[model samples]
Target: MSKRIDPDNRRRYFIVGSVILEIVTPVFRQRLEKDYKSKGVGCLQDFINSKPVIHILFHLRHTNIKCCVDSTNCRNRRKLPLNYSQWDLLYTENPGPPKHHCHCLYTTNNVKLDDLDVTLASLILLNCCNLTPNEEISIKELREFKNNYLSHNIKGAITEKEYQTLWNDLMTYVLQLDPSKQDDFIRIQNRPLDDSLCNKYFVCLLDIHKKLEEISDKLESSTAEILTAINGQSNMELLTKLEEILQYVRCQSPKEKTDNHGIKQQTPIQPYKLGQPIVTLHHQINLTSVVNTSWKVTDISMMDDGRLVMCLPVQSRLLICNTDGSQVESIHVQGYPWYAAAVNNSTVAVTLWGIKCIEMYDINNKLKLKFISLPGIMRLDSGITAINNKIVVGGENRLHIIDYQTGKVIQTITTKCNPGRLHGSGDRILYCDNINSNKMYWYSYTNARHHNLTLPSPPWDMTILQNGSLYVVCKDGSVQHVSSDGKQYKPVKTLQTTPGCDGIHYNLTQRKLMTIQNKNRLVTVYNEI
Candidate 1:
């Protein structure tokens, strides 16, 4: 019998709206929408339950992507969810009629991290090239850990007893990063040591792309030889060696660098032309707090029904206020909440520290619906967003996609570095990695990482507009505008605050940019381009 390649062993999948899609035939450009029972838009649960095949040939080597949603399985038609949400307090419900007027409000300034693992828990201190003593020691420890654990295993050091020991140590490191663990192993370590090291090592490996390019040259030559051996049928043993080498070479291909901003950039579908300002400041508001305690505005969003939601991490409240910043209603939750997003007009998902779970709450009733516990030490370092009826959250190393209804983790996307504040639009996910000097990584739904943008300063949070423009608030008090093409980005506006900007949002219905200042405790509004 001929050796069979198991069909079920396929590795990658994509959840588009209510559809579960996998590239069934990579070469033929065919995709299979995994048949599921649900009729409405597919959620993360559908993706988790479906068996799919992963086709590596789908990986893109050029800037142009040649892929499409196979419509054969798309039985239901639904609106492609808005990239940015809308809010209009005057109209009482979200997605209300468009108004030309701009509004701003003061948000809390007492931002505090309840745990070390939450997103933006600590801003990376930069400007100096050398590492801190503690940071250096942590990096050294990471090298030792990798060698003692992974390196030895790869080198054939796998006795059953040794394997168990290695597994235990790996789990120990994972647990320490998990929010549920509060014992001595976590307390004395300050921020998770493993996380710190991982981020540092990633930065140190910035030259990895250069190495990959060098290896790609060798791989090309070896592949040609392998093809010849296959034809001759004489170099079977040599062919096997070449295949092994090719596998390792294919791992991390060189990502193209297109801009001076950071590591790599992709050629935009349509590059932006440099020109006059497309957006300008419209209004500013200085808010006075109703509560006596200090608070920090960590994240912001517009609900479908037009309410403005801001996450007060220190206050453990999801502050809902009108556009003009009057009369605020708050929902209290246990532990400190980092960020929040609207699942719908009536429901919101909040990422919590200490508890280490993302909780879904009924915003109208202010009732806790249920919580989904995180697996391993996955830290939701970035606040959460609802994309295509699923929760999009990220930490240092990965992005977690969860089913909004079930609180089940449907899929996880690995990131290049420690991803902090992130925003999602359709299949494109944009995130900032403070550990890598505030590098912005853009990931498409089909592939792992698409492109990267380096910012002048560490970014606190980002918001995407309806037209695909990206607005990022940096620690340097400047808000940058990246054109839809990703080729042009400039400081569109500046804040007078010292500590600089933190939370940001782009209201699609109103066509405005909303940003919160960490130092001044003020909110600023700008007319969109």
Candidate 2:
């Protein structure tokens, strides 16, 4: 018989959904299990990881049914595209036993047990390296990692040497996670360090040693010609050549000075870091565009031909502008326009806030057809974007990931609360979580991982860099640049701005920053800090 849905499935789903929804919240996550147990589901987390979800309903008529469908869909499948390292962990399968798998976070069935450890370890390792105590370790699970390993059999998969290296790295970060270290991290961010912090903590010994080991044995042999020249030629010419080679080595390895402002940073900012390079502006030039309208610009979209389309919320109008922020055309949108996104060179998609659906426009800014108009979200304050032939709309307590080609929801990722701003880049989605108490939720759609190990401050607008680093402007008037690596980070080098910062975008190819500020209604522009 096909595995029938458990009779207790409804109750179990209700318990799991209710418990997870409640427990993971700001206040509940802070509570101990002993406290949650008092709420009648002491072992709810344990059940969450063990629950077998065979069937999931996409839509349910009742609230109780909603629990079952939503809970089952929130899992990572092996078929999903994971990062290279995560893929490597999967390849190195440890098929010891299913019992060894995580019993509280995820259900183990298809993925090997060893992969689970590796996956969890890798995830923790990423966070351990990138996020400070202020960001990750205030929680109980991370702090408990030092003592508990489910049933306490915490052994390394790699050899002793590799294990020691990983442990040392983890320990160094664990110490940094101490509340004592957060002030230091924040302090160093405000000023430059006297010595090279990168030389010590920043250097992942494993990575460096691996790189060095790969070349070390071959080095002596590759220099055979030089060695022979040195040994046989006792002439002054040989000495001169030797001296030239030494000088070349010295030139190749120049000293690194973070104290200086005119160089590049090799280790880009980590995601959890709150500070980023910024500059201030006082000049307000009307972005000269030809499509003159009394309506204010509510949304901005960039076309493949390097033009911008501005959505006028009041008049249901779109003003197309050139690369220099000059106007190209003014097209009228049917009904009221809320947000829009660049789909391709020939098409752009718009979300009708006043109306109940999405509309697509031709490159000339002419309406092609109405796409998707889910009534549930149209009535709410919502935002939409067309990414990778897919339309992502946020409202109704969920993000509807709809495919434009088929007009279907490919996937629906529950964010658990209201998302203020929704933006997407290269299959990556970022939403400012009104629920994270303001933190931005960045999902690398391919890998199913948060771009950074942690969110910076609760964010307002976010722009993705060429290298996948996130340049975000938080409500606090601070701009933060977080690297994709999700590791150790220091704040900000200001390209040239002061407080009252508001809007920000990374001009990846041009290497510039296009920023708009509310504190000073000026369009401040600068080479990225």
Candidate 3:
């Protein structure tokens, strides 16, 4: 026999689980209806009633379909190019005599809004529906809350304080989707949860867990197939294929500063090729309108996932946004944020102006991880970058490389000029002087060699492409491109802004260039022609 659960703890679980099933699930269904209607369909119910299995499969190609077919002989089955394993929960599974049946089987089962739960509703909203950035964020948060807080509580217990915190967070997400649901949440929270009601909620929670486990099993099978394919390669092809596999595996897991050997892994540099001289504006956003403030953007950096992190010095905050300029979240720091860098996919390190400290944040969780103070009281720290397992910071005419894990200074290098903004690739670090010098410098850690290249104007900030080339923004409203060797330079694009550009970042995967006009409070994105 299983141990009995505490009544209070069971009540806590019941409240959270009930809110998701009763309040959140209906909102997701409504949104799905709205989305389908907007896409030329009359309504979700009508669409399911009229459309055939082929049409449904096409519409839901974005979902996971691994379980729909036999894995041992998957190739023999008539499978669509994408996943749709969650189809049975939403539709009837009648193994048709004509496998590609055109009859509308979904409506025959009379699947209603009540049949949909939080997990299935969330997956449909995220994968099938076209959502605005805010809607996307809300749905993702609700899904995470279910997984982390509700379903994973093996003890079925939650402290009073934790219950309140979780309740508030869930309420915030629910309100974002439908403000009218506020009263529904409050009623569920205060309602008396008896054994019968709690057991019902417990069953719902178990259903969600089962669905999640199915998805996880499918992913594990897919990963195993990939490894098997890699093993079947010839010796000559194995080396190249192994490197590509490693890169893919790294992308799947949480990004780390160092590998298992405690050695820094250099990002593989792609071959350099000059792009066409033509520059086309892809998107632009006014920072003032988004934040409702005229505060200037101090610096900007791009995460591995393509989100933009911008420093707002006057507000002492970091404004995070999607690549299309939709606001994601805002983070407040302890001091004035001068420069920001993506430490990894989920973490960002920011340098504080007039302070000798660097703060690291987990942007995904919206929590501050820790603070690292320099050894001495060297204020005015400006430039910052993360390479491998270390952080490089610029302060007072010198640079300090610190281990990110221990916050210990590993090495310090003296410089002739105070570095303003830093960017690193492989063993080299590129920076511009803070004294308004018309020169850019590149330092190599391997040989301890420093090389300087004179530019047409004072350099403000810089970003490096995957091919090892550099794009430096200058004070004269001109953007300069330098060869990997730091020997050749030319103007790539010149903006006619009054104060020139203050920050620049290159997205190697997307092949887009993002620049910040701090004085104008504008952000412009450009595509390579």
Candidate 4:
């Protein structure tokens, strides 16, 4: 037997629709306006008002019907996509769940209209409702107006009595919602919510507003102290706290930073033509034979003063070498050092394979300062690079940018695949993915855009030059000279060693190509041919 449309079903549909129309629409409008403005478009209100409301209405109505249908079909077949992750399955399934899936918020099945009174208002204002919090509602008057049944149900199936109650509540809330209050509007938008995947987003958002007000009182008195700590070198804890605040502010009120000088103008993505090497190799310097490491060189970094830093993975040792095929100083670290990068004249940043932290070391003093902890990070096999005092550490599907001095994570950049070796030059960070079938990615910090380049044989390690050209080592014993844009590539040279070809580096000052032959235990340096 087909399920009867009950009063409870009608109530849920009405409340959900009312919440979306009153609360959610403004949030969507604000987001759309900001997105348009960032892309250098204008006429914000016109664009927002002209957005197809019919689609939203239809979508909500469809979702409501789906929920009711699914509830009825629950005895016949289990409703699969009732949770948040399976929201995509809604359109595909015959009797789908609601689009929002806000049923989890309410404890009871029979929620009275009076119970949701404060919640409705709070949700609207918090979700950036274009309504004043102080706007009063004439409950008695609205109840009377609702009894008259001003609007008919879209389905025309629900009884007039049931439809009137839903309509009355919706109309009352809509009338009271006024967005003209500047102070309330600013407060609702600026506060940052706890965005962990486990926590309920709406609950966290409300809690953050309360917490921020308390924090605001303390910050006013300690303004100078807080500022000094944020700027200090050893204040890692303070830096992390400040970075959290910075992240919130940037997300809430993101304004495009325009450069009037045009010094940092974006380079047009030119069609890459693969040909001969711009710089050829003259001779090879065998440095790996001196350092008796059984394993491969996972990472390599060249310092400003022409010293080379290389990390051996299984050996757990960092070898410091000069221009000649000689080791300067070799030191052992705690965990399996997967990657290393020269941060400054005296310091180097090292990330481990099994560890969730990046260790910053004072090489001259021979002491470890502090570890920069990466929260919820995993599968960090190798890629590490330093660009503008920030070290970009690669994990499974994201590149984490950490401040070298402060040990604070500045930003997390998502990727298409797991990153392997990283190379930074000027404003660009180039990295090759472990997956994606030998594809290289060029990420621009200036424009915050990523472009992909196809490569032959999965690239093990890569080095980007000052002019944006790349020298990449392949797993199939090939070293290719790839174009800046990565549209084309040419095999400049081929390594003799097969299974051990890994970790490529280019010394800027000396203009030499350095690569590791892991099985043969050799670090080969080739002078330009």
Q: Would you list the clashing residue pairs of candidate 4?
A: 130-179, 131-178, 131-179, 132-178, 280-529, 281-529, 282-527, 288-523
* Residue 478 Cα positional deviation in candidate 4, in Å, after optimal superposition: 1.5
Report every candidate's CA lDDT.
Answer: 0.48, 0.45, 0.67, 0.52
Which digits, one per residue and each the tens of the lDDT, describe model 1 over residues 1-529? 0013221111000000001000101101110111221323153233222222101111111122322333232222133211111011011222323441111111112221111111011111111113455533433343344445332221112345554454444334334323233232222222211211222222222222223344444544557653453443355553443454344333312224333322233222223333335456755656545544385777777764235677777877887664556446788978777777877655788877645678887654567898778753246465467776678887547788887667677788787766667777655777776443756777776444567777787776787765467777777767777776566677754433466677788754445667787567777766644
Give one digit per residue, the lDDT tens place, for model 4 in 1-529: 0124454443334333333322434433443345445655463333222223212222332343322313442222233212221122112223334554322212212222222223232322232223233332332333233223312222212355665555545444434543332332232222222121101122122222233333443443344454453333365543443444433332222222334422142232223335454444433445455555465677777665445788876777787765454435777788788788887655888888877888888654456877878763554575788876688878777888777667777788887776767877566788877554777787876667888877778877788653457877777778777877667778864443565467778754345567777666666665533
Question: How far is 230's C-alpha from truth in model 2 (Å)?
Answer: 34
Each candidate's clash count: 12, 11, 6, 8
lDDT of 2 by residue, 20-123 (tens): 12112212222323333454543433312223311111111112232233455444443432343433432333454444332122232333222232223323
Q: TM-score winner among the candidates?
A: 3
Candidate 3 clashing pairs, residues 3+ apart or interchain:
63-83, 64-84, 64-85, 65-83, 65-84, 65-85
Q: Give the worst 10-residue stretch by lDDT in candidate 2.
A: 53-62
Model 3 agreement with the true structure over 228-329: per-residue lDDT tens digits? 543334554334333333333332222224444344434433444443253468778776766665578888887754567989878878888766676457
Native-to-model Cα distance after best TM-score fit, residue 127 in candidate 3, in Å: 32
Candidate 3 lDDT (Cα, whole model)?
Answer: 0.67
Assess every candidate by TM-score. 0.47, 0.43, 0.51, 0.47
- What candidate 4 gets wrong by more than 4 Å, as runs, is 1-293, 379-382, 494-500
Clashes of 2: 11
